[model samples]
Target: MEKTTKHPKQSFTVMNELVLPNDTNTLNNLMGGRLLHWMDIAAAISAQKHSNRIVVTASVDNVSFKQAIKLGDVITIEALVTRAFNTSMEVRLDVWAENIPSGTRHKSNEAFYTFVALDENGKTVPIPEIVPETAEEQELYDGALRRRQLRLVLGGKMQAKDANELRAIFYKD
Candidate 1:
Protein backbone atom coordinates (compact mmCIF):
# COMPACT_ATOMS: atom_id res chain seq x y z
CA MET A 1 0.00 0.00 0.00
CA GLU A 2 1.20 3.52 -0.79
CA LYS A 3 1.74 5.89 2.10
CA THR A 4 0.00 9.23 2.37
CA THR A 5 1.79 12.43 1.53
CA LYS A 6 3.31 14.57 4.27
CA HIS A 7 3.82 18.31 4.70
CA PRO A 8 7.28 19.78 4.78
CA LYS A 9 6.77 21.11 8.28
CA GLN A 10 6.40 17.56 9.53
CA SER A 11 10.05 17.00 8.77
CA PHE A 12 11.54 20.34 9.72
CA THR A 13 14.58 20.16 11.97
CA VAL A 14 16.65 22.79 13.72
CA MET A 15 20.10 22.38 15.23
CA ASN A 16 22.25 24.76 17.23
CA GLU A 17 25.95 24.66 17.92
CA LEU A 18 28.48 26.83 19.64
CA VAL A 19 31.91 27.62 18.28
CA LEU A 20 34.56 26.99 20.91
CA PRO A 21 38.28 27.37 20.85
CA ASN A 22 38.73 23.89 19.46
CA ASP A 23 36.20 24.50 16.71
CA THR A 24 38.07 27.52 15.36
CA ASN A 25 41.09 27.76 13.09
CA THR A 26 44.15 29.98 13.30
CA LEU A 27 42.07 32.95 12.17
CA ASN A 28 39.59 32.30 14.99
CA ASN A 29 36.90 31.32 12.52
CA LEU A 30 34.97 28.10 12.60
CA MET A 31 36.38 25.39 10.34
CA GLY A 32 34.48 24.57 7.18
CA GLY A 33 34.69 20.86 7.87
CA ARG A 34 33.08 21.22 11.26
CA LEU A 35 30.23 23.27 9.85
CA LEU A 36 29.73 20.67 7.12
CA HIS A 37 29.49 17.90 9.68
CA TRP A 38 26.77 19.78 11.53
CA MET A 39 24.89 20.43 8.34
CA ASP A 40 25.04 16.76 7.41
CA ILE A 41 23.61 15.70 10.72
CA ALA A 42 20.77 18.20 10.48
CA ALA A 43 19.96 17.18 6.92
CA ALA A 44 20.09 13.48 7.73
CA ILE A 45 17.70 13.96 10.61
CA SER A 46 15.24 15.76 8.36
CA ALA A 47 15.45 13.04 5.71
CA GLN A 48 14.95 10.31 8.26
CA LYS A 49 11.92 12.05 9.73
CA HIS A 50 10.34 12.47 6.35
CA SER A 51 11.09 8.90 5.22
CA ASN A 52 10.68 7.07 8.52
CA ARG A 53 13.66 4.88 7.66
CA ILE A 54 17.40 4.82 7.67
CA VAL A 55 18.94 7.14 5.13
CA VAL A 56 22.36 7.56 3.57
CA THR A 57 23.72 10.71 2.05
CA ALA A 58 24.02 10.24 -1.71
CA SER A 59 25.24 13.68 -2.72
CA VAL A 60 25.65 17.24 -1.53
CA ASP A 61 25.22 20.27 -3.75
CA ASN A 62 27.95 22.87 -3.99
CA VAL A 63 28.19 24.76 -0.69
CA SER A 64 29.32 28.36 -0.72
CA PHE A 65 30.87 29.79 2.40
CA LYS A 66 29.47 33.26 2.29
CA GLN A 67 30.83 34.60 5.58
CA ALA A 68 33.42 33.44 8.04
CA ILE A 69 31.89 32.41 11.36
CA LYS A 70 34.07 33.63 14.17
CA LEU A 71 34.78 31.74 17.35
CA GLY A 72 32.31 31.99 20.29
CA ASP A 73 29.51 32.50 17.84
CA VAL A 74 26.27 30.54 17.86
CA ILE A 75 25.35 28.63 14.73
CA THR A 76 21.81 27.64 13.91
CA ILE A 77 21.07 25.09 11.21
CA GLU A 78 17.59 24.76 9.80
CA ALA A 79 16.71 21.76 7.67
CA LEU A 80 13.63 20.58 5.85
CA VAL A 81 12.62 18.02 3.27
CA THR A 82 11.86 19.95 0.12
CA ARG A 83 10.82 16.96 -1.95
CA ALA A 84 10.93 13.20 -1.91
CA PHE A 85 11.41 11.04 -4.98
CA ASN A 86 10.96 7.31 -5.43
CA THR A 87 13.78 6.26 -3.14
CA SER A 88 15.56 9.49 -2.40
CA MET A 89 14.71 12.82 -0.76
CA GLU A 90 16.20 16.26 -1.20
CA VAL A 91 16.86 18.07 2.07
CA ARG A 92 17.42 21.80 2.03
CA LEU A 93 19.49 23.43 4.76
CA ASP A 94 19.99 27.04 5.76
CA VAL A 95 22.87 27.92 8.06
CA TRP A 96 23.04 31.06 10.18
CA ALA A 97 25.73 32.47 12.38
CA GLU A 98 24.97 34.65 15.39
CA ASN A 99 27.27 36.71 17.53
CA ILE A 100 25.77 36.84 20.96
CA PRO A 101 27.98 39.60 22.21
CA SER A 102 26.82 41.99 19.51
CA GLY A 103 23.38 40.40 19.04
CA THR A 104 23.98 40.09 15.33
CA ARG A 105 22.94 37.23 13.10
CA HIS A 106 23.71 36.64 9.47
CA LYS A 107 22.06 34.43 6.93
CA SER A 108 25.10 32.44 5.88
CA ASN A 109 23.96 30.23 3.01
CA GLU A 110 21.84 27.36 1.90
CA ALA A 111 22.66 23.94 0.44
CA PHE A 112 20.92 20.80 -0.67
CA TYR A 113 21.61 17.23 0.36
CA THR A 114 20.20 14.09 -1.19
CA PHE A 115 19.55 10.96 0.84
CA VAL A 116 18.28 7.52 -0.09
CA ALA A 117 16.10 5.61 2.30
CA LEU A 118 17.01 2.05 3.20
CA ASP A 119 15.20 -0.77 4.91
CA GLU A 120 16.50 -3.21 7.47
CA ASN A 121 18.19 -5.20 4.73
CA GLY A 122 19.95 -2.09 3.48
CA LYS A 123 17.88 -2.04 0.30
CA THR A 124 16.52 1.19 -1.06
CA VAL A 125 12.84 1.86 -0.36
CA PRO A 126 10.26 4.33 -1.50
CA ILE A 127 9.72 7.52 0.47
CA PRO A 128 6.53 9.37 1.24
CA GLU A 129 5.65 12.24 -1.06
CA ILE A 130 5.63 15.79 0.27
CA VAL A 131 2.76 18.24 -0.13
CA PRO A 132 3.80 21.83 0.12
CA GLU A 133 1.55 23.90 2.36
CA THR A 134 2.76 27.47 1.92
CA ALA A 135 3.90 29.64 -0.95
CA GLU A 136 7.54 29.22 -0.05
CA GLU A 137 7.13 25.49 0.37
CA GLN A 138 5.34 25.27 -2.94
CA GLU A 139 8.12 27.13 -4.69
CA LEU A 140 10.77 24.87 -3.26
CA TYR A 141 8.69 21.83 -4.05
CA ASP A 142 8.24 22.92 -7.64
CA GLY A 143 11.93 23.73 -8.13
CA ALA A 144 13.09 20.46 -6.63
CA LEU A 145 12.38 18.56 -9.81
CA ARG A 146 14.54 20.87 -11.87
CA ARG A 147 17.31 20.58 -9.32
CA ARG A 148 17.04 16.81 -9.36
CA GLN A 149 17.24 16.70 -13.11
CA LEU A 150 20.26 18.98 -13.04
CA ARG A 151 21.97 16.75 -10.51
CA LEU A 152 21.30 13.62 -12.55
CA VAL A 153 22.62 15.25 -15.68
CA LEU A 154 25.73 16.51 -13.93
CA GLY A 155 26.30 13.15 -12.24
CA GLY A 156 26.14 11.32 -15.60
CA LYS A 157 23.17 9.28 -14.45
CA MET A 158 20.91 11.02 -16.99
CA GLN A 159 21.83 12.37 -20.38
CA ALA A 160 21.21 16.01 -21.21
CA LYS A 161 18.73 15.00 -23.86
CA ASP A 162 16.64 13.29 -21.22
CA ALA A 163 16.76 16.18 -18.76
CA ASN A 164 13.56 17.86 -19.87
CA GLU A 165 13.27 20.16 -16.88
CA LEU A 166 16.90 21.18 -17.14
CA ARG A 167 16.69 21.69 -20.89
CA ALA A 168 13.69 23.91 -20.41
CA ILE A 169 15.91 26.28 -18.51
CA PHE A 170 18.38 26.82 -21.38
CA TYR A 171 15.99 26.27 -24.30
CA LYS A 172 12.47 27.67 -24.45
CA ASP A 173 9.79 27.08 -27.07
Candidate 2:
Protein backbone atom coordinates (compact mmCIF):
# COMPACT_ATOMS: atom_id res chain seq x y z
CA MET A 1 0.00 0.00 0.00
CA GLU A 2 1.19 3.51 -0.82
CA LYS A 3 0.40 6.75 0.93
CA THR A 4 -1.47 9.47 -0.92
CA THR A 5 0.97 12.20 0.15
CA LYS A 6 4.61 12.39 1.10
CA HIS A 7 7.03 14.97 2.44
CA PRO A 8 10.05 15.81 0.31
CA LYS A 9 12.42 14.70 3.05
CA GLN A 10 10.89 11.24 3.04
CA SER A 11 12.39 10.59 -0.37
CA PHE A 12 15.85 12.04 0.30
CA THR A 13 18.59 9.92 -1.20
CA VAL A 14 22.37 10.20 -1.08
CA MET A 15 24.85 8.43 -3.33
CA ASN A 16 28.64 8.58 -3.32
CA GLU A 17 31.21 7.51 -5.91
CA LEU A 18 34.96 7.77 -6.14
CA VAL A 19 36.09 9.25 -9.43
CA LEU A 20 38.49 6.66 -10.81
CA PRO A 21 40.73 6.90 -13.83
CA ASN A 22 38.03 5.32 -15.96
CA ASP A 23 35.56 8.00 -14.87
CA THR A 24 37.88 10.87 -15.78
CA ASN A 25 39.13 12.32 -19.02
CA THR A 26 42.58 13.27 -20.26
CA LEU A 27 42.42 16.41 -18.11
CA ASN A 28 41.90 14.16 -15.06
CA ASN A 29 38.46 15.68 -14.42
CA LEU A 30 35.40 13.52 -14.00
CA MET A 31 33.55 13.08 -17.27
CA GLY A 32 30.29 14.98 -17.59
CA GLY A 33 28.52 11.87 -18.86
CA ARG A 34 29.58 9.89 -15.81
CA LEU A 35 28.29 12.57 -13.46
CA LEU A 36 25.02 12.71 -15.36
CA HIS A 37 24.60 8.96 -15.06
CA TRP A 38 25.18 9.08 -11.32
CA MET A 39 22.69 11.93 -10.96
CA ASP A 40 20.08 10.01 -12.93
CA ILE A 41 20.39 6.98 -10.67
CA ALA A 42 20.25 9.07 -7.50
CA ALA A 43 17.22 11.05 -8.71
CA ALA A 44 15.40 7.97 -9.92
CA ILE A 45 15.86 6.37 -6.51
CA SER A 46 14.48 9.45 -4.81
CA ALA A 47 11.47 9.67 -7.08
CA GLN A 48 10.76 5.94 -6.71
CA LYS A 49 10.85 6.24 -2.94
CA HIS A 50 8.37 9.11 -3.08
CA SER A 51 6.00 7.30 -5.41
CA ASN A 52 6.59 3.80 -4.10
CA ARG A 53 6.58 2.64 -7.73
CA ILE A 54 8.98 2.21 -10.56
CA VAL A 55 9.89 5.55 -12.15
CA VAL A 56 11.30 6.45 -15.54
CA THR A 57 13.33 9.48 -16.46
CA ALA A 58 10.85 11.89 -18.03
CA SER A 59 13.26 14.76 -18.55
CA VAL A 60 16.43 16.42 -17.27
CA ASP A 61 16.61 20.18 -17.02
CA ASN A 62 19.61 22.29 -17.92
CA VAL A 63 22.75 21.07 -16.14
CA SER A 64 25.70 23.42 -16.02
CA PHE A 65 29.09 22.06 -14.99
CA LYS A 66 30.21 24.94 -12.81
CA GLN A 67 33.27 23.23 -11.31
CA ALA A 68 35.37 20.32 -12.45
CA ILE A 69 35.69 17.26 -10.26
CA LYS A 70 39.15 15.71 -10.31
CA LEU A 71 40.01 12.01 -10.32
CA GLY A 72 40.19 10.36 -6.88
CA ASP A 73 37.64 12.82 -5.53
CA VAL A 74 34.59 11.43 -3.77
CA ILE A 75 31.45 12.57 -5.55
CA THR A 76 28.41 12.86 -3.37
CA ILE A 77 25.02 13.24 -5.01
CA GLU A 78 22.02 14.21 -2.96
CA ALA A 79 18.52 13.93 -4.41
CA LEU A 80 14.97 14.47 -3.26
CA VAL A 81 11.57 14.84 -4.82
CA THR A 82 10.56 18.49 -4.71
CA ARG A 83 7.10 18.15 -6.18
CA ALA A 84 4.76 15.47 -7.54
CA PHE A 85 2.09 15.92 -10.15
CA ASN A 86 -0.51 13.42 -11.29
CA THR A 87 1.97 10.77 -12.35
CA SER A 88 5.28 12.55 -12.40
CA MET A 89 7.65 13.93 -9.81
CA GLU A 90 10.37 16.59 -9.99
CA VAL A 91 13.64 15.64 -8.32
CA ARG A 92 16.35 18.11 -7.34
CA LEU A 93 19.97 16.91 -7.31
CA ASP A 94 22.95 18.57 -5.66
CA VAL A 95 26.39 17.34 -6.65
CA TRP A 96 29.50 17.86 -4.61
CA ALA A 97 33.13 16.80 -5.06
CA GLU A 98 35.36 16.13 -2.09
CA ASN A 99 39.08 15.42 -1.92
CA ILE A 100 39.28 13.45 1.30
CA PRO A 101 43.06 13.40 1.40
CA SER A 102 43.21 17.18 0.93
CA GLY A 103 40.11 17.71 3.09
CA THR A 104 38.56 19.99 0.50
CA ARG A 105 35.10 19.92 -0.97
CA HIS A 106 33.57 21.86 -3.85
CA LYS A 107 30.09 22.14 -5.24
CA SER A 108 29.73 20.92 -8.79
CA ASN A 109 26.19 22.00 -9.60
CA GLU A 110 22.49 21.41 -9.12
CA ALA A 111 20.02 19.92 -11.59
CA PHE A 112 16.40 18.98 -11.79
CA TYR A 113 15.16 15.63 -13.07
CA THR A 114 11.58 14.69 -13.79
CA PHE A 115 10.38 11.10 -13.38
CA VAL A 116 7.09 9.40 -14.13
CA ALA A 117 5.76 6.50 -12.12
CA LEU A 118 4.85 3.33 -13.96
CA ASP A 119 2.71 0.33 -13.22
CA GLU A 120 3.35 -3.38 -13.83
CA ASN A 121 2.48 -3.14 -17.52
CA GLY A 122 4.60 -0.02 -18.00
CA LYS A 123 1.62 2.29 -18.00
CA THR A 124 1.74 5.64 -16.24
CA VAL A 125 0.49 5.52 -12.66
CA PRO A 126 -0.67 8.17 -10.24
CA ILE A 127 1.87 9.08 -7.57
CA PRO A 128 1.78 10.70 -4.18
CA GLU A 129 1.61 14.46 -3.76
CA ILE A 130 4.47 16.37 -2.11
CA VAL A 131 4.14 18.35 1.10
CA PRO A 132 6.93 20.84 1.54
CA GLU A 133 7.78 21.30 5.18
CA THR A 134 10.45 23.97 5.10
CA ALA A 135 10.68 27.40 3.48
CA GLU A 136 13.41 26.19 1.20
CA GLU A 137 11.34 23.16 0.27
CA GLN A 138 8.38 25.41 -0.43
CA GLU A 139 10.47 27.60 -2.72
CA LEU A 140 11.70 24.57 -4.69
CA TYR A 141 8.17 23.19 -4.80
CA ASP A 142 6.93 26.50 -6.22
CA GLY A 143 9.66 26.76 -8.83
CA ALA A 144 9.26 23.20 -10.06
CA LEU A 145 6.11 24.06 -12.00
CA ARG A 146 7.74 26.95 -13.81
CA ARG A 147 10.75 24.83 -14.68
CA ARG A 148 8.52 22.02 -15.89
CA GLN A 149 6.56 24.40 -18.05
CA LEU A 150 9.75 25.67 -19.63
CA ARG A 151 10.85 22.13 -20.38
CA LEU A 152 7.53 21.32 -21.99
CA VAL A 153 7.73 24.40 -24.16
CA LEU A 154 11.27 23.59 -25.25
CA GLY A 155 10.37 19.96 -25.93
CA GLY A 156 7.32 20.98 -28.06
CA LYS A 157 5.01 19.20 -25.67
CA MET A 158 3.47 22.53 -24.70
CA GLN A 159 3.01 25.91 -26.29
CA ALA A 160 4.64 29.07 -25.02
CA LYS A 161 1.27 30.79 -24.66
CA ASP A 162 0.15 28.10 -22.25
CA ALA A 163 2.96 28.68 -19.81
CA ASN A 164 1.16 31.00 -17.39
CA GLU A 165 3.81 30.95 -14.71
CA LEU A 166 6.55 31.82 -17.17
CA ARG A 167 4.38 34.50 -18.67
CA ALA A 168 3.81 36.03 -15.27
CA ILE A 169 7.54 36.32 -14.75
CA PHE A 170 8.43 37.55 -18.23
CA TYR A 171 5.42 39.28 -19.73
CA LYS A 172 4.01 40.75 -16.53
CA ASP A 173 0.82 41.86 -18.25
Candidate 3:
Protein backbone atom coordinates (compact mmCIF):
# COMPACT_ATOMS: atom_id res chain seq x y z
CA MET A 1 0.00 0.00 0.00
CA GLU A 2 1.26 3.47 -0.82
CA LYS A 3 2.00 5.56 2.22
CA THR A 4 -0.79 8.01 2.84
CA THR A 5 0.43 11.58 2.61
CA LYS A 6 -0.38 13.88 5.47
CA HIS A 7 -3.01 16.55 4.96
CA PRO A 8 -2.16 19.49 7.15
CA LYS A 9 -5.25 21.57 7.47
CA GLN A 10 -5.31 25.10 8.75
CA SER A 11 -4.96 25.32 12.49
CA PHE A 12 -8.10 26.31 14.40
CA THR A 13 -8.67 28.27 17.54
CA VAL A 14 -10.91 26.32 19.80
CA MET A 15 -10.85 28.37 22.99
CA ASN A 16 -8.55 29.72 25.67
CA GLU A 17 -8.66 31.21 29.11
CA LEU A 18 -6.55 32.77 31.80
CA VAL A 19 -6.19 30.70 34.89
CA LEU A 20 -7.83 32.44 37.79
CA PRO A 21 -8.57 31.75 41.40
CA ASN A 22 -12.13 30.71 40.72
CA ASP A 23 -11.03 28.32 38.00
CA THR A 24 -8.85 26.46 40.46
CA ASN A 25 -9.52 24.16 43.31
CA THR A 26 -8.26 24.80 46.83
CA LEU A 27 -4.81 23.78 45.68
CA ASN A 28 -4.67 26.67 43.19
CA ASN A 29 -4.28 24.26 40.28
CA LEU A 30 -6.52 24.53 37.27
CA MET A 31 -9.57 22.28 37.48
CA GLY A 32 -9.73 19.24 35.26
CA GLY A 33 -13.23 20.03 34.09
CA ARG A 34 -12.16 23.48 32.97
CA LEU A 35 -9.36 22.08 30.90
CA LEU A 36 -11.71 19.55 29.34
CA HIS A 37 -14.12 22.30 28.45
CA TRP A 38 -11.42 24.23 26.64
CA MET A 39 -10.32 21.10 24.82
CA ASP A 40 -13.82 20.48 23.51
CA ILE A 41 -14.05 24.04 22.29
CA ALA A 42 -10.77 23.66 20.43
CA ALA A 43 -11.90 20.45 18.80
CA ALA A 44 -15.14 22.04 17.67
CA ILE A 45 -13.23 24.87 16.03
CA SER A 46 -11.11 22.41 14.06
CA ALA A 47 -14.16 20.50 12.96
CA GLN A 48 -15.85 23.68 11.81
CA LYS A 49 -12.77 24.77 9.94
CA HIS A 50 -12.74 21.49 8.03
CA SER A 51 -16.46 21.33 7.36
CA ASN A 52 -17.39 25.04 7.39
CA ARG A 53 -20.38 23.95 9.43
CA ILE A 54 -21.30 23.28 12.99
CA VAL A 55 -19.95 20.18 14.63
CA VAL A 56 -20.56 18.20 17.76
CA THR A 57 -18.26 16.18 19.93
CA ALA A 58 -18.84 12.49 19.39
CA SER A 59 -16.28 11.48 21.97
CA VAL A 60 -13.07 12.51 23.69
CA ASP A 61 -10.17 10.14 24.20
CA ASN A 62 -6.91 9.90 26.13
CA VAL A 63 -6.96 13.21 27.94
CA SER A 64 -3.70 13.29 29.89
CA PHE A 65 -2.70 16.03 32.26
CA LYS A 66 1.05 16.21 32.12
CA GLN A 67 1.46 19.30 34.26
CA ALA A 68 -0.49 21.67 36.44
CA ILE A 69 -1.44 25.26 35.66
CA LYS A 70 -1.30 27.65 38.51
CA LEU A 71 -3.23 30.85 39.00
CA GLY A 72 -2.30 33.92 36.91
CA ASP A 73 -1.33 31.78 33.97
CA VAL A 74 -2.52 32.15 30.42
CA ILE A 75 -3.66 28.94 28.82
CA THR A 76 -3.71 28.58 25.06
CA ILE A 77 -5.72 25.77 23.55
CA GLU A 78 -5.17 24.92 19.90
CA ALA A 79 -6.54 22.14 17.74
CA LEU A 80 -5.57 20.72 14.39
CA VAL A 81 -7.43 18.35 12.13
CA THR A 82 -5.43 15.16 11.89
CA ARG A 83 -7.79 12.65 10.33
CA ALA A 84 -11.23 12.26 8.90
CA PHE A 85 -13.59 9.38 8.25
CA ASN A 86 -16.90 10.11 6.57
CA THR A 87 -18.41 12.87 8.68
CA SER A 88 -16.09 12.50 11.59
CA MET A 89 -12.81 14.32 12.14
CA GLU A 90 -10.19 13.60 14.74
CA VAL A 91 -8.70 16.72 16.29
CA ARG A 92 -5.57 16.73 18.37
CA LEU A 93 -5.42 19.52 20.93
CA ASP A 94 -2.43 20.78 22.85
CA VAL A 95 -2.92 23.04 25.85
CA TRP A 96 -0.02 25.22 26.84
CA ALA A 97 0.14 27.23 30.03
CA GLU A 98 2.30 30.33 30.23
CA ASN A 99 3.37 31.60 33.57
CA ILE A 100 2.87 35.31 33.89
CA PRO A 101 5.89 35.94 36.04
CA SER A 102 8.44 33.86 34.21
CA GLY A 103 6.81 34.17 30.76
CA THR A 104 7.57 30.52 30.25
CA ARG A 105 5.15 28.18 28.57
CA HIS A 106 4.68 24.47 29.19
CA LYS A 107 2.42 21.90 27.66
CA SER A 108 0.08 21.15 30.50
CA ASN A 109 -2.39 18.82 28.85
CA GLU A 110 -3.07 17.04 25.62
CA ALA A 111 -6.13 15.21 24.26
CA PHE A 112 -7.69 13.72 21.17
CA TYR A 113 -11.29 14.59 20.40
CA THR A 114 -13.61 13.15 17.78
CA PHE A 115 -16.13 15.49 16.20
CA VAL A 116 -18.83 14.88 13.64
CA ALA A 117 -19.66 17.62 11.20
CA LEU A 118 -23.31 18.63 11.28
CA ASP A 119 -25.62 20.29 8.84
CA GLU A 120 -28.42 22.68 9.69
CA ASN A 121 -30.48 19.74 10.88
CA GLY A 122 -27.70 18.62 13.17
CA LYS A 123 -27.08 15.48 11.14
CA THR A 124 -23.64 14.25 10.17
CA VAL A 125 -22.06 15.95 7.15
CA PRO A 126 -18.95 15.34 5.14
CA ILE A 127 -15.75 17.28 5.75
CA PRO A 128 -13.12 18.49 3.30
CA GLU A 129 -10.02 16.37 2.81
CA ILE A 130 -6.86 17.39 4.71
CA VAL A 131 -3.49 17.63 2.97
CA PRO A 132 -0.32 17.73 5.01
CA GLU A 133 2.36 19.83 3.30
CA THR A 134 5.56 19.29 5.26
CA ALA A 135 7.47 16.61 7.11
CA GLU A 136 6.34 17.93 10.49
CA GLU A 137 2.79 17.93 9.29
CA GLN A 138 3.22 14.32 8.19
CA GLU A 139 4.54 13.45 11.62
CA LEU A 140 1.56 15.09 13.28
CA TYR A 141 -0.78 13.22 11.00
CA ASP A 142 0.91 9.93 11.89
CA GLY A 143 0.63 10.73 15.55
CA ALA A 144 -3.03 11.35 15.12
CA LEU A 145 -3.43 8.01 13.41
CA ARG A 146 -1.80 6.22 16.31
CA ARG A 147 -4.01 8.08 18.73
CA ARG A 148 -7.10 7.22 16.71
CA GLN A 149 -6.31 3.54 16.82
CA LEU A 150 -5.72 3.75 20.53
CA ARG A 151 -9.07 5.48 20.91
CA LEU A 152 -10.82 2.71 19.04
CA VAL A 153 -9.21 0.05 21.20
CA LEU A 154 -10.05 1.89 24.38
CA GLY A 155 -13.59 2.54 23.23
CA GLY A 156 -14.14 -1.09 22.34
CA LYS A 157 -12.95 -2.14 25.73
CA MET A 158 -15.14 0.41 27.43
CA GLN A 159 -18.26 -0.63 25.55
CA ALA A 160 -17.76 -4.37 25.62
CA LYS A 161 -20.43 -6.14 27.61
CA ASP A 162 -18.32 -9.18 28.36
CA ALA A 163 -15.17 -8.84 30.38
CA ASN A 164 -13.51 -11.58 28.36
CA GLU A 165 -14.30 -9.77 25.14
CA LEU A 166 -12.94 -6.58 26.50
CA ARG A 167 -9.78 -8.29 27.58
CA ALA A 168 -9.33 -9.86 24.18
CA ILE A 169 -9.79 -6.56 22.41
CA PHE A 170 -7.42 -4.84 24.76
CA TYR A 171 -4.78 -7.50 24.28
CA LYS A 172 -5.11 -7.84 20.52
CA ASP A 173 -1.96 -7.08 18.53
lDDT of 1 by residue, 1-173 (tens): 11223354448888899999999999999999999999999999889889999999999998989999999999999988999999999999999999999999998868999999999999999989988888998999989999999999999999999999888889999
Colliding residue pairs in candidate 3 = 6-132, 7-130, 7-131, 7-132, 8-131, 8-132, 14-42
> Which has the higher TM-score value, candidate number 2 or candidate number 3?
2
User: Could you give candidate 2's per-residue lDDT for residues 52-123 as a string of tens digits?
Assistant: 899999999989899999999999998879999899999999999999999999899799999999999999
Note the Cα lDDT for every prediction shown: 0.89, 0.89, 0.75
State every prediction's TM-score relative to the real structure.
Answer: 0.94, 0.93, 0.79
Which 10 residues in a row give candidate 3 its minimum summed lDDT?
Answer: 1-10
Model 3: per-residue Cα lDDT over 1-173, one tens digit each? 01112234555564668888989999999999988987787678767777788988988986888998998899888777877767888887888999978979999888778888888988888877677777876876756655655666677843433344335556775
In model 2, residue pairs whose N, Cα or C atoms come closer than 3 Å (at least 3 residues apart or on different chains), thus clashing, are: none
> What would the TM-score be for candidate 1 when compared with the true structure?
0.94
Q: How far is 173's C-alpha from truth in model 2 (Å)?
A: 3.7
Q: After superposition, how far is residue 114 of candidate 2 from its true place, in Å?
A: 0.6
